[model samples]
Target: MSARARRWPLVLLLGGTLLLSGCGLFGGDEEEDPPAELLKFKPSLQLRKAWSARVGDGSEHLRLGLSPATDGTLVYAAAHDGRVAAFEAGSGKRRWAAKTRLPLSGGPATDGELVVAGSSNGEVIALRAADGKRRWVGRVSSEVLAAPAIGGGLVLVRGVDGKLTALRQDDGSEAWFVQQSVPRLSVRGTGAPVIAGNVVLAGFDNGKVAAYEMSDGTLLWETLLTPPRGRTEVDRLVDINATIRVVGEDVYVVGYHGSVALLALESGQVLWARELSSYNEFALDFLNIYVSTETSEVVALSRRNGREAWRIATLLNRDVSGPAAWKNSVVVGDFEGYLHWFNAANGELQARMRAGSKRIALAPLVVGELLVAQSEDGKLYAFSERGKR
Candidate 1:
C-alpha cells in the first residue's frame, strides 16, 4: 500500500474506534448498542451571535491543526488549503488574507507582528500581521502537526518526526533544534509547545514531557507522564499528544491511555496524578481543571487535589473538542457542529448553539468575552453573552 493508503486507518483509529470496531466483520458476536440520544433541555442562559466570517476550505479528510490565534484586537485563523486570514475581534471584519499555494497542515501562530504556519511539504511560511505580506519561509525535517509557539525571540515548532526546531522571529533562521525518541506506533497528532518565562514545554509520542530553555534549546528536565505498560504494542500505546497547561507554579498535562498529572514547574516533580485518557487541550479556573476525555465525556476536577468534581457523558461518541471556560460556564463543541454550554459550578446544561452543518474539529477560542468557533465547513462564528455589549 502507498503511504497515503496506510494513513487512512490511523486517522480513523485516532478519531474513534467505533467507526470500525463495532462492525460484525470485526468478529464480535453480539450487536453493539446504539448511541444515546441527545437530551432536550431548557435554556438557562442566553447567547447572541456577534459576527461570522469564512476563511477557506477547511479540513476535509485531513485533521488540520488550524486554529485561531489572537493579539487582543485581531484574530488569526487558517485553512488546510493554505489560506490564512485575519479579522477584527470585535466586528469580525476581514483585515487581510494571504495564500501560500501550499498544502498547510499546521499553524497560524503569531506574536503580534508575525504570523507563522507550516505546510505539509515541511516548509514554514511567515507573514506580516499588518497586511498579510509574505516575510520569510523556512524548512524543517518533516510535517508539522502542531501550532508553533513564539517566545524569547524564537518561533518554536514541533514536527511529527518528534523534533522541535526553533527559528528566529525576525528572519526565520534556525536558532536551535532538539529531537526525542519517536515511538514506532503512536497517535497521529502532536501537542503544541507552551512557553512560560524562559522555558518551553512540549510532549512527545513516547509518553514524556520535556522542558527546554527558550534562548538556547537546552534540555532543562524531562519527566515520563505515563510509562508504557501491557504486553502488546497496541496495549502499551501511551502518547502525550495533549498540550501542556501552565498555571502559576504548577504544570498540568495528559496522555492517551494513561494519566493526567500535575507537576511542579521548577523541578518537574509529580505532585499528583489521576488515571485519564485525553488527546485534547484543557481549561482551568481558580478551582477546577476542565477536560474532554477520549470517550467524549466532559469532566471537571479540582486543581488543588486532582479530585473529580463532575462529569457529563451525554455527548459520548460525538468526538467532542476540549472544554473552554467562559464566564461562569464551560463550552465544548461536537462533531455535529453543536456547541454545548454547561454551568461550571455544576454540570447542568445551560445553552446550545449550532455553528454549521459540518463537524467542529477544534475547541472554541475564547477572546475576552466573545466565543469564537470554526466549523469543518470553513465557517467562523463569534458569540457573546446575550445582554452584554
Candidate 2:
C-alpha cells in the first residue's frame, strides 16, 4: 500500500499526531489563519434563559452522555442516576419523570412518539413520550456508551464492544446484530451511528467504517478507515470519537487521536485526507466542516478538498468542544463553561456567554430559534439570538 493508504487507520483514530502518540507530545502545533474578509458574516445567535430544573441526582466522575433531546416543544433527557425526564422546551419545566435503575451512560434519542436511551450495563429502554412510562427494555451483552440513532422506524445502536444492533422502534425487539473486533486500546466510545439512505454507518476503534443494510441487517459494505501501525508503532491502534456524518454521496468521519478524511460512500474511495492534529468532532453546515482542537483552536475546512478555510485560537486548552451550526452562525462550547458563537461565512467572533459550570462537556444544539446545550455539570441551558436582530 502507498504511504497515504497505510496512514488511513492512524489518521482515522488520532489525526496526524498518531506518529507522536501519548497525548501528542511531539505533534505539530501550527496556528491557523483566519479566512478572507469576504467570508465574514454576522451571526445573530445568542442564548436566552427560558427555564431551568434539576431532574435526577447525577453522579460525580460519571462522564455520562445524557444530552437533552427536543421535539420543538418538549425536551427529553436521561439522567446519570437512571432517570428520564420530559421538559417544556421553552420554560424548562418538568413534565414527567420515569426512573430506571441502570446508570444512563448514553444520551436520549426520540422518534416522534417514543423516547429511547441506553445504559452502561447493556440495556436499552424505551418510554412513552406523553406519560414518560416504561414501554420496553432491551438488553445486549456489551455496555452502551453512545446514543442510539432513530430513523426509518428503527433504532440503530453501537456498543462499547464494537457491536452494532438494530432494535425495533415499537417494543425494543432485536431486529439484527453484528459484531466486529475491538481495538486493544480504545478511548471511551462516544460516536453514534448515522443512517444514510439504505445503510447505517458507524465508526469503530478497529479503524474501519461498516455500513449495514437498514432493513434486514445484511452487511452492505465495510471499509477499513486505515491500516495498523507496523511493529514500530504497535501501541497506536485506531481510536475514533464516533462522529460520522454523510452528506449526499460523501461521508465525513473523524476519531480521537487520528486524522480526518472525506470518503466517497459509493465506492469506499478516499477523496481527500488532512492532518488535523486534534480529536474534536466536526459539524457540517452545508458549506464547511467546523472542528476544534484539543489545544483550544477552532478551524473551518472546505468539505470538497480538505483545504483550510479559517482558523482561530481560543483561551481554552482542555475544554475545546466541537462546533455546531444554526442559521448563519456556528456555535461551540468549551470546558470553561463559555459558549462562543461565530459567523459561519467567516471565522469571526460574534457573541459569547459564560454558561457557568466547568466539569462537563458542553455541546450546543441550535433547534429552530432555540440554542440548547447540556453543561458538563448536568444542566440544560437555552439561549436565543433575539437581541442580535
Candidate 3:
C-alpha cells in the first residue's frame, strides 16, 4: 500500500473503532463524537488490598515496565527515579533500598543470588538479593527496553539496536551477540525473550521470531509472525514486537500493528495467525490468549487455533495497560488507575478496583492470591479477593 493509503487505514481504525468510555453523550460537543454503550457488569468477585508500598515515580505518557519482583519472603521493586526497594512480603515493611540514580525502565530478573535489571542508559546492573548491594554492571551498545531473561546459566539481553547478547550468569562477560535486523519505522524494540526447553526464543521488531541454541547461539529456527501481506510498501513495514510466550512446544507471539501468531518451537511452522495489536503485552491462561489493543479493547482468542473467543470494549481511548492472568481470571489496568478483572474465558467484567489517583504502569500481577499494582505517581498497592461470596 502507498503511504497515503496506510495512513488512512490507521486513521479509520482509530477514528471508527475507539472511544474513551461506553457511555451516552451529555452535551452537544460530546454528541458529535457519540459515546459507546457502557456494558454493565455484575459483581462476581471482590478485591481487597493485602498490602501497599511506594516504589518509584513513573512517566505518564510512556509505559516504564517496572514490575514488582518477589522471592516468596522478600519483594523487590524499582522506582522510575532509580531506587530499588526490598520489602518483606508478609509485612510490606521496607527492608533495603538501592540507589541507581538513573531511569530503571525494565523489570528485574532473578538469578537466585542476584537480581538483574537494565537502565535506559544501556547499562545492565546486578544487585545482591540478600541486601540490595551492587554486584556487577555491564553495558550494551544501545538502550535496553525489555527485561533480561536469565536461563540456562546465561543472561539474555536484547538491545534496542536489535542485538541479542548472551552473557555469562556468573560474570558479566559476553557469551555471544547476534545482530538482527530492526523494523525501519518502529519506535521501540522487542520484549523479553523466553527460555524454552533447550532454546532461547525471542521475537524481533522485523516480524521474525527466532529460536537460538542457548549454549552456542546458533540459529535453530526463525518464524515470521506477520508475513508480507499485500506485497506493498506498507506490507514491508509490517512489524512484530510481541514478547515471546512459550508453552510446551508452541510459542505464542503478537504483532504490534499486524497479527498474533502461534509458532512451532522445533519446526518454526506458524500454527495460527490472527489480527491483534498489543504494544504492551498479553496474558495467557491455559487455553485462552488475552490481548489488549491500543484502542482499549480486550480481545480473547483461542490459544490453540487463534480463533476469536470474545471481546470486551473497555472503551478507553488512551493506550491500555497489559493484561495479567490469575487462575480463571484476567485483570488489566488502565491509564486512569482503574483495575478491571474479567473472565478469562469470555472477556466478561467481574470486578473493578482503583489503585490510586494516578495511572497504573502495566498489568497488575497476582502474587499468592493478592494482586500487586503500582501507579505512575510512585505508589504501590495490593488487591485480593474479599472472600468466598
Candidate 4:
C-alpha cells in the first residue's frame, strides 16, 4: 500500500527533530489542511429525532463495539461500564436493564431468545431476553471485541487474540475453540464471526478468512484475503477487523491495508477483489456495498462485480464511522457526533444532523421505520423521516 492509502497517520522526522502531531501529523500543516469542513447543503430529507435514551456510563472514547442491536421488535444496547438494556423497538421504552460489572465492551447481540454481551476481559454473558435475567457466563482466552455470533444453539465469540470460542447457548459451556496464527504486529480488533447455515465464518489478524463447521468445529475452507507485504511491521499489517457480510452463498471480507474481496462461501474461491481498506464495519443492500475507508471516505461499490459506484470524500480525516443503508440513503457518524446522510444512488448529500455531542463510533441500526445510533457517551438516538412517525 502506498503512503496515501495508509489508514493511520504516519510519523515523520525531519532535520533530527520529530514533527509534532499538531503541526503536521496529517502529512501537512494542520491549519492549512484541516479535516474537510462541513459544507452547507440543501436538505432533501428532513431528519427528525424520534427518541433518545442512555444505556450506561459510556465507553469513555475507547471505541468499543457497543452498538445498538435488534431482533425486529426490541433494541439491545451495552455499555463499557457493564450495563445492558433493552428498549421497545418503536417507542424507545425501557424493557429491562442489567448490571454485569464485567466492563462490557463488545456486544448485545440478540437472537430474540437470548441477549449476549462480552467484556474487555474475555468474559461472555448471556441474558434472558424476557426479563433481562442472567442466564450463563462463559470464559475465553482474550478480550472479546466483536459481537458474539449466535446460531445453531451456540455462541461464537471473536477474541482479540485471534481465537474464536464456541459456547453452548443453553448453559454457556465450551463447545470448541479455534486459534489462528496472528501476526506479531496487527490491529487491536477482530471481525465478528458470522453464522450462515451450518458454517461459522471469521477473519483473522493474518488477513485470512476461514469457515468452520458449526456442529463439530471442523475446518471447512480458508482463503487469504490480504497478503502482508513491505519491510516494517506497520507496513505488513493486514488485520481484517471489519465485520464480514454474507448474502446468500457469497461472503464479503475487507482488511486493513488490504483488499476487499468476495469469496465463494462453500469453496473459499475468490470471486472478485477490490483494493480498499477499512478497519470499521460496512453495510450492504441488495445492489450496493457501503464502506467507510480508513481515511474516512464513505464509498459505494457494485456488490456484484466489485466496481466503484460512488464515493463521498467530504468527511475525510474526520474519524467517520461506517455507513448504514437506510431506506434510500447511506448514513454515517463522525468524531464530532454529526450524522451525514447521502443519496444511495449518486452520493449526493441528502441530510445531516447532530445526534449527540460525543462521537458516534458504530454504524447506526435500522429498525422498522426508525434509524438508531449509539454514541460514545452511551446515548442512543432514534431518527425518523419527517413523516415517519
Local distance difference test, each candidate: 0.82, 0.70, 0.71, 0.85
TM-scores, each model vs. reference: 0.92, 0.83, 0.85, 0.92
Give candidate 3 misplaced runs (Cα > 4 Å).
1-41, 228-237
Instruction: Output the worst ten-in-a-row residue range by lDDT, candidate 2.
Output: 1-10
Residue clash pairs of candidate 1: none
Q: lDDT: which is higher, 1 or 4?
A: 4
lDDT at position 161, candidate 2? 78
CA lDDT for candidate 4: 0.85
Scanning candidate 4 in windows of ten residues, the lowest lDDT window is: 1-10
Native-referenced Cα lDDT, model 3: 0.71
Backbone clash tally (model 1): 0
Clashing pairs in 4: none
Put down candidate 2 lDDT per residue, 140-251, tens digits, no spaces: 6666766788888788888877888998887788988887887645554557888998888888877777778899878777777666664534345565664688999999
The sequence of per-residue lDDT tens digits that candidate 4 reaches over residues 1-389 is: 22232234322232233323322333442334346789997999997999999999876446577888899999999999898999997889999999998898798899999999999888999999888899999999877878999989999999877888999999999999998987756665667899999999999988999999999889998899978888777678788988899999999988888998899998999999999888889999888999999888999999999999998899977778888999999999987789999999999999999998887887899998999999999889999998877
Clashes of each: 0, 16, 3, 0
Candidate with best lDDT: 4
Model 2 backbone overlap count? 16
**Where in model 4 is the C-alpha error above 4 Å?**
1-33
lDDT of 1 by residue, 35-152 (tens): 4467898999998989989988867546667778898899998887888999999999999999888778787888898989987778899999999999999888877877899878
